[model samples]
Structure formats: C-alpha cells, structure tokens
Target: MSGGENSSRLIDVVLDESIGRSTPDVEHERAVAIFDLIEENAFHPVGDEGGGPYRLNLSLADSRLVLKVTREDGGDVVTHILSLTPFRRIVKDYFLICESYYQAIRSATPSQIEAIDMGRRGLHNEGSQTLMDRLSGKIEVDFDTARRLFTLVCVLHWRG
Candidate 1:
C-alpha cells in the first residue's frame, strides 16, 4: 500500500478501538461530544457558524476530534473520524493520550531511520512477514513485529 493508505489504515484501527472499548475513562465524554454535535438530523452549520462543520465546546471541555457516520441511500453505513491522532485513552476530567509507536522501514528521518533500518536487533526481532508478503516484499515482518502489529488488528476488530 502507499504511505497515505497505510497511515489511514493505522488511524482506522485506532479509531475503531476508541469506538468500542475506549480506555473506559475517555469514552463517556467522547460519546456525549458526538451526541451534542449531532443532536438533530438537521445538525447544520459547524461551530456556531464561524468556522467549519466542527467547533470546540470549551465549556464542555471538548477535543477537536469529531466522529461521524452517515448512510447514503439509507444502506450500509460506515464511520468517518476526523483527527490528527484524535483518539485518546480517556476523556474524563482531562483527556489522556493513547500511545502508539511505529518504526518505519523507509522514509523515516535520516538520523532515526538508520536505527530502525537496522531493525529490532539483539536477538529480539524483525518486522512481520504477513504484511511483507501481502506487499510483495515491499513490507516485512518478524515474529516480534507481528506481535506488535496484532495490537492494531485487535483494536480494529473490537466491538463495544
């Protein structure tokens, strides 16, 4: 897959997790935030009319992430989440972060790329073969790397 495609896939997995078993603490407000935003089917004009279709409700202690779903032709629907790393571990009194990391095989910054380029060393691991195979050798995987990637798959498959 292309870089943008991979990035979006990663984001989807994270957002799917947030929709279901969302760290418990942040789930409630995140749900409520979505509710308020879509209080009516006629919900129109974003953010009190000044900005776009989204606005921060500071009194409500909001986050910029907006999760939306819509059905075209009243058929099967899908979720649309807007964020730059938007999902959080919790959104209780204060928003807590969801931590995720990746080691790129390419296009990573020069200084850091070399370290990851060497890949996970010390008899520890390499990347995942499944992804690599699917990518026609463009991607790679070692057992440890597959284990790391399982988190992404698990989150995407989770249901509330």
Candidate 2:
C-alpha cells in the first residue's frame, strides 16, 4: 500500500472497566490520549482485510496486556496479548518523571520545567518504541499512534 492510501486507523477505542479506578487527572490524561489517537492515527492490521476503521479494546487480564482488535462493525480481526514484564521498568520511570514534571510546573523555573518535560518526552518515546517492537507482525502503527497507545498502557500499568 502506498503512503497516501488512507492507511487503516482506529475509529473507536475502549479500555476495559476492570482496569480499576482512576483519579480525575488520570482519567483526563486517558481521555486526551484516546481523543488524540483516534483523531489522527495510523493502525494497519496485518493480513488482507481491505483496510479498516477499526475498534480496539485495551485491558489487562492475568497480568498480561490484552489487545482486542475488530472491524468497525464488530467483526473479530486479531487479539494480541503481551506480557507486562518488559514494560515494568519504563512505565515506572515514566510515572516518576510525570510526577516530577507536574511538581516542576508549580514552583520550578521555566528552564527546569522544560528540562523535566523533555526527559518525560524522551522516556515516553522509549516506551512507545518498545511497544511498537512488541507489536511487530501483530499490527502496524505509526510513531504518534504508538506514543498515544503507550500512554494508555502506562495508565493500565498504574493498577498493576
């Protein structure tokens, strides 16, 4: 497929309710990430499926990240389950940096805040790259899509 072929992308995304409770901030973050993801993303599932506007459900079950992908009308496409072990360290670091970034916003100088935010973005990129690596052959997603999906994964890790 060519670059301008209207690559498959998500039409709707749902996170399982069993993922556990979330604070308002976490919820807001999730909302923004999902909104951004669906607004503009590149998600092309492997195999011939005539391209798609897919629906994805993300959840955690038995310590594994469960990704359930389907067509817009609910036809099953693929289910990808990935272990959480690989993401543990990066997610932990991401959360810690996020906390610091939030704090830095309160009293730190502009430069300090910018530096912390840069570190946060760096870690975020690392996490997203890890996700893309893990998702290889399962589904294809662009960097920005991976980044947004990484945020959702980190949100799930919050309860793990």
Candidate 3:
C-alpha cells in the first residue's frame, strides 16, 4: 500500500491476554470492534515518521493503559501510556448498562430494550470522546475510530 493510504489507518489490533479472559458477550464485542475498526478507521500517530497501517496492541500495566503502535512490518513506532483513572467510572457504568441491555434483550419489550440500548450507546460515545480527548496530541483519530477503540479499552478492563 502507498504511504498515504497506509499512513492513517490501523491494519491490526490485539488485546493483552494477561488482562483476563472475557465472557462470551465481551468476546463478541471485542471481535466486532476489531473487525469494524480494521475495515475502516482513521488512526494516525502524531509526529510519526514511518507513516502507518499500524499494528496496535492494547494492554494494562501498573494500573495504566498502554497503547503500543508499530509499523505494518513490525517496526517500532510509538507507545502511549494513559492513566486508567479517568476511565474507571465510565467503564463501570458502561458494564452495568450493558448487562441491563443484555438482560432486556431476552425478556423485556422492544421499547424497553431500545431504551436500555440507547443508554449503553450514550455511555459508549462518552467513553469514545474521553479517549479522543486523552489522545489529543499523541494519536489522532476520528470519533468512529475512537468509539471502536473505546470498546477495545473496555475489553481490557473486563475482569471476567
């Protein structure tokens, strides 16, 4: 791929297995988010000289979020370490809403299910915006990309 085409997107994404295994629901969400993110996203590491089509590895260490980026050929690019403190409450609340949404899908009326989903989506968007704000000068990503990344971040926070 040409540098321009490759420079602004991620070709691969991985979550650290050390974090903990996820439930089936979380696994499904992780798969879909990675697929959607790779299919289309705007991810450009600011001040990167190698250009992109980057490979991103998401992990948590020392209670912080680590975003390790690399070139398509596995060359080193940049690693961003962000605090998890800002995400704790959002992630907690998001999981709660997600649980409600999942439960609603099984027994609640369509309207109830929709209402719960709306709340879940709102939280997701909020998380996305927070991520974007945090990455302001490090990694530039569009809102859609941020949303998918937020899902992956939640996957990292998944304890079960």
Candidate 4:
C-alpha cells in the first residue's frame, strides 16, 4: 500500500451539505469526477500524517475552499483552507468557456464545437495546474487527479 499503487488514493469524497440543487449535467460531472478520482489516483499527504487511502470532504466557506481529509476509518488527517481569490479568474474563464462549449454542442457545427471543447480543456488544464501549485507541500496528487479535483471545486463554486 506504500510504494506506487492506487492504495494511496481517496476512497471516498463528499460535498458540503449545503450544495443544494444543481443541473443534471453538473451533478453528473461531480459524480464522475469523484468516481474517477477514487478509482485511480495518487494522493500522498506530506509529513508524518502517514500514507492514505483517504476520504476527502470539499466545501466552500467565505470565499475559501476547504479540503477536509480523513483516514479511511474516519480518523482526522488535515484540513487545508485555501483562499479562492487566486482561482477566481481561471474558474470564471473556465465556466464561461464551458458554457460556450455546451451551447456549441447544441447548435454549432462540428468544427465549432471541437474548437470550443479544445479551449475548455485548455482552461481545465490550467485550473488543474493552479490547483497542484496551490496544494504543493500540503498534499501530493497527479495531474489527472488534480484535474478531477478541480472539477469538483468548480461544482462547489457553481452557486457563488
């Protein structure tokens, strides 16, 4: 469970209680992100916290993103509070592009949709990279894992 295996990944992930209602697509995106993240990810907490199989709870509070991690058995691990200020611009751009992508899918030509999707993926990658940079020294995760986590963060910010 130590070296390089999926054993160090998150076993469960939950959103805050007040997430309220979301569009079907939004809910689907959240579900897939969590499922894919837990299924295959490399997440190793820094310091003497010990290796995981961890559970993560994501929430937004007062313009901050709260990541509460716990052991598989529910023991406390670490709570990382990150100010959302740095992510504001990127998230906004991502959402706006995503909306365009979705709309393009409905009526635009194939090439148009593809172009919008490419832009969407680029923004998504940028957001993921920012997340990795922000989480550096606090938690370790691979690029794909960070991308999925970024999706969850966007979902959490949907109402804001």
Model number with the top lDDT: 3
Tell me the TM-score of model 4. Answer: 0.88
Clashes of each: 9, 0, 0, 0
lDDT of 3 by residue, 1-160 (tens): 5557757899999877756677897788778878988988999999987787899988878999889999989999999999988999999999999889989988999999989999999999999999999999999999999998898888767655
Per-residue CA lDDT of candidate 2, range 1-160, in tens? 3343654888899988867768887787778888988888899888846667789998889889899998878998889899988899999999899889989999999999999999999999999999999999989999999998998888766632
Candidate 2 lDDT score relative to the true structure: 0.86
Q: Give the Cα-based TM-score of candidate 3 against the true structure.
A: 0.89
Native-referenced Cα lDDT, model 3: 0.89
Kindly give the stretch of ten consecutive residues in candidate 2 with the minimal lDDT sum. Answer: 1-10
lDDT of 2 at 40: 83
- Tell how far residue 29 is off in model 3, in angstroms: 3.3
lDDT per residue as tens, model 1, 1-160: 3342222111111233333455554555345434432332121122122212222221101222232322222221232222222123212101111111143323457757555434333111212233223323222233433334323332322232
**Model 3 bad stretches (over 4 Å):** 1-3, 23-25
Order of all candidates by lDDT, from best down to worst? Answer: 3, 2, 4, 1
TM-score of every model versus the real structure: 0.22, 0.90, 0.89, 0.88
| Cα RMSD (angstroms) for every candidate in the order listed | 16.7, 2.7, 2.0, 2.3
lDDT of each: 0.29, 0.86, 0.89, 0.84
